[model samples]
Target: MGAVRETLDAVRLVDHHCHGTVAADLGRDAFESLLTEGEAWPGISPFDSPAGVAVRRHCAPLLDLPRHTPAEEYLARRSELGRREVQRRFLRAAGTDVFCVDTGYAPDPLTTPREIAEAAGGTSYEVVRLEGVAESVQTAGVEPDAYADTFRTAALEAVRRPGVVAVKSVAAYRTGFDLDPARPSEVEVTEAARRWFARGGRLDDPVLVRHLLWTAVDLGLPLQLHTGFGDSDIRLHRADPARLTDWLHLTAGTIPVLLLHCWPYQRQAAYLAAVFERVYLDVGLTLHHVGPARAGGVLAEALEITPFRKLLYSSDAYGVAEFFHLGALAFRQGLAELLQGRVDADELSLPDALRIARWTGRDNALRVYRLEADGPEDD
Candidate 1:
């Protein structure tokens, strides 16, 4: 058990799914808004939440404050440090070796992929977003007949970007997973594209969204899909990964499907990972939101039936550098405790526990994205 704990502490993580941090300083209002999955109401501070407390206890020290510093003082210290140094400190503290960043959603100014890589002293790779490409095609005025082909071509080009390791979709935010599993015919896609262009807003039409996913499959890169838990945009019940069963069946053996942030549905995700050879999952955003205290419980549920090889580590950190620090802290602490307990109980051998810790924290992601070759074993 002691050996297991020591190994996880030293294992450099590969954050397989995350977003870039901001490039500029944030006022209290802007900063608080990024802290939660919902809007900050008139009176309540995001500082009162689990994530907030975690930051104060875990991340405050990195900014040169005592643990559990008051929120007001914490914010003041952050503003005093300025932006670049803040990012550098937090990214370095995370001790991550590689970052697979999703460059899709940036409501605020964010560090670019290269900037993030530089700040952390690690490699950074891109995960292209599927819907952003389709929306761009619409904004660029493609003819209805050309929409399907144009989107497919654009997506193909997007993945060819030098650092792109994979592609992602926020269909969970748009239409949910009850979508029909079958691919739309060319005619259906053309008509759906025509309606979408006329409606002229987000690309939410069910048919077109499915087309985007299938296009992801055709591109043959590993595809990441937002699963349970997100901002107000997600319809909680509809976002369940179980609803994706048929779609998974239809696309089986086509490409790897990585489920992101499956909380509350971590069990469902674990079930899927048990059955689907190409399916993988991570409880990323969920960890930061639950904070360090509950990270072990959440991780235990995610690993209950999940194959060790099918689980990967992610921060899903966006906008806030505190999350980069907190997420890594929570993962290392929680995963270490859980695996060490198994070793103590004699449920797993010392060697097996160490292997699982290494796989979940780093090696699994490296293999999933094919960043580099790893030995073939599921220890």
Candidate 2:
């Protein structure tokens, strides 16, 4: 008990993946207001029907509306939204000191890179991480198969960036389910990705995902994959994390692949994490769907069997600052207490408690991202 308490106390964690920068740009007040009004941010799909719209209005304030204006208005708000003041305020709720900003769609060249670096340095945390995916397929109308070379080139370049710390692919079903891990062979998937690129689809295809995995392994880099259940249209059957066995087998001992929030399928995800040697996971969307109570239970169950060291903290924070702030705070408190069990209250040690927190909080990301090592420091 003392050691667990001490472990949780010494924890120094980082949110491996977050869209805090986008929330910062929204200005706290604006974000709060919009959230109250029921607008959806980019991470979760937008509402389409009148009923959905009504639901968002009721649920908006509960969301961390990290932004106020439309995508077109981002540039003018950069200066104020990019500052450390908002970041510090946000971190006060969650005990993290660093976060990685995913700048996949910054319109302004200067703003995009600058935001990444600056956000890291902001009060809530430091280190702005950059990432790049094969935009050639979607933007160029090329076949998914044709984009392999282009993806490779882009990934190589992204890896070279000074602040980039990881590589990722947005190929899986973002709706409510996970992709069938048993689906096509890696080669088949890669070819499909190439064709998707050729067709001018804006999303990464299977080919790019295969190439990204191989490249990450070769470079000793960590890769984040959009797994589990997300979006509304995703097939629940395909969303099971169990199907990732083959994929995990392929990357075993080579490079780490993080499964992001399989939610309803978290048990499945946890089971896979327990079996895989190099797999890691995060509960990104659970903040919204599972609530703090259930989230605590789910996470505790996962940590009890799988190595606690393999878990990482993340909200997949996007659209609003409050969402990131509160979600993170809830995770910290929930996870901390969950790990404590029925220990003597007077025996609690902040350092031990923090250390436990770090295992799932920041240490996992550091190890997976290989951030402490001296190298290119990018993907």
Alpha carbon lDDT of each predicted model: 0.90, 0.54
Residues 120-218, model 2: lDDT tens digits = 343222222212455533464545455555655666666666766666655455322233333345467556764653565444344444445565666
lDDT of 1 by residue, 225-334 (tens): 99999988889899999999999999988899999999889999999999999999999999999998999999999999999999999999999888888889889888
Model 1 stretches astray by more than 4 angstroms: 373-379
How far does residue 68 in candidate 1 sit from its true spot (Å)? 0.9
TM-score of 2: 0.68
Q: Least lDDT summed over 10 consecutive residues: which range in candidate 2?
A: 122-131
Considering summed lDDT, which 10 consecutive residues are worst modelled in model 1?
A: 370-379
Alpha-carbon deviation at 166 in model 2, angstroms: 1.1
lDDT score, residue 147, model 1? Answer: 96
Each prediction's TM-score against the native? Answer: 0.97, 0.68
Instruction: Name the best candidate (by lDDT).
Output: 1
User: What is the lDDT for 148 in model 2?
Assistant: 55
